[model samples]
Target chain A: MRNILLTISYLGTRYHGFQVQKNAVTVAQTLQDAMEILLGRREDIKGCSRTDAGVHAGFYCLNFKTENPMPLPRIQRGLNGLLPWDISVRGCREVPEDFHARYDVLGKRYRYLIWNSPARSPFWEGRAYSYYPPLDLEKARAVCRAYVGSHDFSAFCSVKSDVEDRVRTVTHCGIEREGDLVTFTVEGDGFLYHMVRIMVGTMFWVNEGRLSVEEIPAIIASRDRGRAGKTAPACGLYLDRVFYDLEGLRWEEGKDLG
Target chain B: MADLENIEHLRKKRARIGFLKKALALLLIVAAIALAVAFRHEISRLNLVEQLTSHLVGIGSGPGWPVDISGITVREMAPMGNDLAVLTDTDLIFYSAQGREIRRVQHGCANPVMKVGGTRVLLYDTGSREIRVESKTRTVGSKTMEYAVDTGDISANNCVVLVTQGARYASEVTVLDKNLAQLYQWRSADSRVMVAALSDQQDEMAVGTVNVRDGQLYSTLLLFRFDEEQEYVREELAGELIHSLRYKQGCLQALSSRRLLTFSETGKRMAEYSLGEETLTAFDSGAELFTTLLVGDYREFKELDLAIVDYTGAAVGGSQLDFQVEDSTAAGDRVVLQSGGTLYLYGGGALLDEMAPLMEILDIQLVGKNLYLLTPSTLEKITVR
Candidate 1:
């Protein structure tokens, strides 16, 4: 048997989420169906992370063990041919038989997009979150900086999650603006349920002057979820990249950010 | 042999389950595609029930709808006889006065200009020489002019008047009857014809021409008879270009940049109202009893003044509005002024009602109490009451 790693991207507008469910269509189930058609048998897939409904993935990692001797390129092309247009297999590679797709992940990056315009864009429907008020990037940048380093992010995680240990180290955090699109990017070793969305939502409050920029650290230390802002919508959240190497995806301070 | 048969039967049963699963997946895909097409607008927002209701009822389509005009460029919209006509670059669509889509006709005009006359409409391409005249249901006739069309109009009787570049002169006015037969043709000598109109009575045609003389612009209003060799009545105004000219009840009403002047059929000035220094922003002479005008102090319309004047150049109703007027139209005795998403309705020289619509109002047309509003995406009808 050979263990394979796959990097994939998908537009999650029409999907329920990354996890498979009995009644709902999900990314995992779709991939399993496509792989069954291509390899003539079912293969269990392990995803690196679970995304909410309407949350997209620009780059995601997954792994599956198969006894069939298939080339990486053929597996990619064959899976792409059977999968829907919105979901695509970006790259494939061989891994050790004992390698795990989820447990071995070093860090991951997430990006949230905001269309900061009064008028809605037709092309960006279902792809971005539309915010009418003008965003103050300087204040939002300060909020992003306050989120760097390590802290218990219980204030930012959703209350529905039952995880006891919520402490995580955030490696990189920044915000960039290009024309009408505002991008908020954060890299962390792991994320709790809806943690990135909550951080972005709190940043939005700071931008609108509803919350002070200096209060972000206090909110994190308080560990009270009610102290933070509301969770930002899932449509604007995207799993941007998954890093297997610690030194490869670390962001240098004051460096050019996309 | 019996053991081999048992294994083969089990293999066949497992293969049957796989085939059934594949078939079920295909069926789900087809059903999903069907649902997406049926509820495209609502599916974008994931409001499936509202979409089903919109499809089933066809009324009360929520404040967000009448279909999003994301990719459509609406050129012009006007009120047909009893329906509303919206002309885009690719299609001419008609809707009932109740705001239900009635019919549509495909058109091929690159730079389309639409002129509505009664139940018929004239679609002309300024980039090309093609003109198509269509009724509410189907196209009546189509014609190709010798030169590029400059501007055109259609009379209530369906008589078409087109101003095109003349081969031997500056411009020409060509009139065609309802059947598209050439009724009258005249070529200008030196002036460029800015506007042309056929009288409601259909016995006369009027042309407004502008030319520069002695370093100043001069405009002339000429009325012609079909049987006459030359213009029957000619009137000239110096330094003012005529914007619109129409005939109402034997009086020829001409609106220029600075004034509204009315003249008799024999070219005698009747009653004139000077606008002084105020800039005329918009005017509509579609109504028979009154014409509505919106004026502002500067071209950048901040606060506007609305003037409703009768054909005899008398003010029926007028008011200074605090908001800028985007568009205004008059029909019967009512005038509707659209400012942003709000509409101010006036009837009998009094402010009747002020309404704030859910969608943005791009243009408006008023007929009695039924006001047709054109938004970026949909055509809506609202009653003044």
Candidate 2:
């Protein structure tokens, strides 16, 4: 037996999430179905994260063990032939049997896109969040700096989560703007439920002048869920990059800003 | 003196017994050799002798012969450009003339079926509404019908004909142009379309349909022009179910369960050949001038009689085969029959070539001089001798 790792990407508009649900279709179920056709047997899969419904992913990792010795190129071609048009297997490789896709993750980066234009784009519909208001770019950039470093983020966590330990380390938090599009990115060791969405929502509040950059640190100290802004829509968020080792990632401030 | 005479008589009796045993052993050895020679066709089907011979001669064991098709179940195949188009249960793959896979695309269908005409190939789902028209290189167009598709075909001029279940009638025929524009449509209130084909000139069409009349099933052949709403000729065939219909050399030829009927361009019945007691096992009318039929004594595992007839319903040439045929097809003037792992190619009523491939042949198609053989695990392209 050998452990096979596959990196995939999907639109996520038609899927419930990355996990198998009893009543709804999901990315994990779709991948498993395609794999079953290729390998001629069903193998259990492990995904890197439980992405929320309607949340897209640019890069997601999954692993499964199999006895079939199909070459990697043939496996990739066979899977592409079986998978749907919306989901695709980007790459595949054999990994160590002990390497777990979920447990071995060191950190993750999430990106939120905002189409800050008055008119909605037909091409980006169901793909990006459309906000018509004029956002104060300077205020949004300043608010991003306060979210870096370790802190108890109970204010940014979803109220539905019951994890008592709320302390997390945010390695990089940055905001950039390119014309009518604004991008907010955050990298962290781990996150609570709806943590990235809440952070993007808080940045939106600061951009709107409803909250100040100075109050973000106080909001973290307050440890109150009510102190943060609303969780942003799921369409704008993407699980962009997954890291098993943090030493390889290079970060720079205002690198992508227009 | 009496005891010595009795001993001599006993020795002579023992010698006679040994002589009889030697003769009996010689006769058994001769019978076994005769049986092996007589039943060689049955033994060849197990591929024991052919495999051993091919291994010793290093024939058909070379690379680049049998293209791998292990993962997909092939449903239909046809010649595309100089290559071949194979429609599986899920995908459409194009292989080169040398049996090398060139490209593959998902047809996104469950029960995928295919028809190839000129450079265009039409793929449709049997119980679904989706249909796609693709050329040798790329997809030309696609359409979704209002009702599920029953069957369809493509013309040499790239026109598409689709027969689908009707909303208000028993069946409907929709014709589309080369660019997938709606050209014409017809609906039948009582009959269901079984097979349809367009003329080579693209000016006329022939449709075969079946309907129950007074509790007796009847087959009808309808011929129509592209601009006319009503059929110019309708021939009713009682107690028959049409299996195939095609237009060849300005005449419409149709095959039913029991008869082969041909009609002239003026709606006149030219000739008809009926199978009185024998059963029609397999038939193909894809050839330019002749159609091949495999008929037997209405029983399984019986050797079939090959019948090659022209478009005028006249017998050209045929012969009885020693092996039961799985599939038979005709192209140009040659007829190819697949029985087990061997292929018999006959031209002008004479056997041209016989090849016993190393793999099992499931289906075969002879386009031009290239013979495409579908195996259980691969597709092989061989040249006719």
Candidate 3:
């Protein structure tokens, strides 16, 4: 059997997210069903991470073992043709037999979009969250800086998460503002369930003047979900990318690989 | 017999080496092809840039103009001249073609007022409940004449011909001579006037009224001639709940919850276009007879969608632009919309240009054929030739 890695993107407005649930439509279920139909076998497909409902994915990774002799290109083309319009398989490639999609992931990045306007938008109704109140930019930036470092992050994680290790290192976090639009981008070693959303919610409170930047440390220390801001809506959050080390992959000397 | 055996073994070894070489070469070739395919998207993006650069227009070598005012928002542009008036959060600024601020009218209210006009300036101060009119030309040494009316505009010379509020929403059609004196105040029969519009020639105005019954908003439109004795005529239009109304040329455009209705300035409904499930937020009429609709969240701290529709109630081709708010100022009036570090220009159903990223774009305006974008650092002029 040959292991194949696939890069995918999807608009997550319609599905329950990247994982499969009982009688619920999901990105993984659709991809798995399509693979089964094309290969005539039910092979377990593993995703790098799980994104919540209404959260988009620009670049997600998945892997599965197939015994069929069909080439990687054919599998990619077949899966793309069968997938829905909202989901797309960007690429497919053969990988080492030991390669796994989830455990091999080195880090992940996420972005949260905020539409800061006094008016509602019809076009971006499902795409972004609209915040119409005046926001304090400096306070939001300060709070974003506070999130950059290693911390338990227990207070930021959701109550329903089963993971026991809440300690995660945030490598980078920044906030940028364009005309009436603000985005929070964060890269970390790993994130707990609803961690990014809750962090964004805390930042929103900082922008709203209800919470101060100095209070972030206390919220992190509290280790209680109630101490943090309300969890941000799911629609505005997106899994931007997943990074992996390429030590084993071989490449041509003068050829650019990106 | 020993030499023959050695020769046979050497031949087998040579064949094995050849096969290994061929396999190595094949692996190298596959790796090269994969790398090329992986970078194909980046190469295509470069090609797009090259194509766009061939059609790019360079910025003119002009000196920077001084813009001292803050909270400035462009209101309307003049068709014949290079005149554009902007409403600041507190004051109104009029600019000449040379980028000189000619007039600045101050409104004492803390909240910003919405301004409307082509050559003449009408300021609607909702806080003070007053309407002020000023001519483009300096008639009284930069001092604008102000009027205090009892009710807001239910309709006026613009698409709103009457101004009314509360149960006794009184609408008065006042005609002024060149000196800004009230020539006549014509009152309407209805107590509440919700929407209004004025003709291009300033000779006629249409008024719409709303009466809420059983938690439903019902509306009516009326047209009046602005003469010595104001003549009133009621015309029937098929629509409900006029939320926004604007008059350009002789066409009266009213935005209802269901569709956009177009009527003659004389109150004749010409055509209707449905807006589907899209809600109307902010509406601005252009100088060249087009209207811009900023539809999104109407409350505080919400994102908005923008669309431009022409006079005939048709969506302007290539006029849909999306922007996201990244951060907001302390006052909440000035918001930063993320444009992905690029500037987009739209006019007449076409995207004019995607200019290089300037500072942050704060506000946009279509003045005559020139599109003016006020960035945080510069005022960019995009000429649609």
Candidate with the greatest lDDT versus the true structure? 1
User: How do these models rank on lDDT, best leading?
Assistant: 1, 2, 3
TM-scores, all candidates, are 0.49, 0.48, 0.42
TM-score of chain B of each: 0.78, 0.78, 0.60
1 versus 3: better DockQ goes to: 3
Q: Give candidate 1's root-mean-square deviation (CA, Å).
A: 34.7
Clashing pairs in 2: none
On lDDT, the stronger of 1 and 3 is: 1
Cα lDDT tens digits, model 3, A73-184, are 8888998988999999988888889989899887888889888889977777767788787767788878888998999998888776778999998888888888877888
Count of clashes in candidate 3? 56
Give the least accurate 10-residue stretch of model 3 chain B, judged by summed lDDT: B327-336
Q: Write the per-residue lDDT of candidate 2 for residues A151-252, one digit (tens) a residue.
A: 999888877688999999898888788888888898888888888988887787777676789999999899887777667778998888777632332233
**2 or 3, greater by DockQ:** 3
Error of 3 at A185 (Å): 31
Model 2 bad stretches (over 4 Å): A1-258, B1-64, B298-301
The whole-model C-alpha lDDT of candidate 2 against the native structure comes to: 0.80
For model 1, the local distance difference test gives 0.81
CA RMSD per model (angstroms)? 34.7, 28.9, 29.8
Each prediction's DockQ?
0.00, 0.00, 0.01
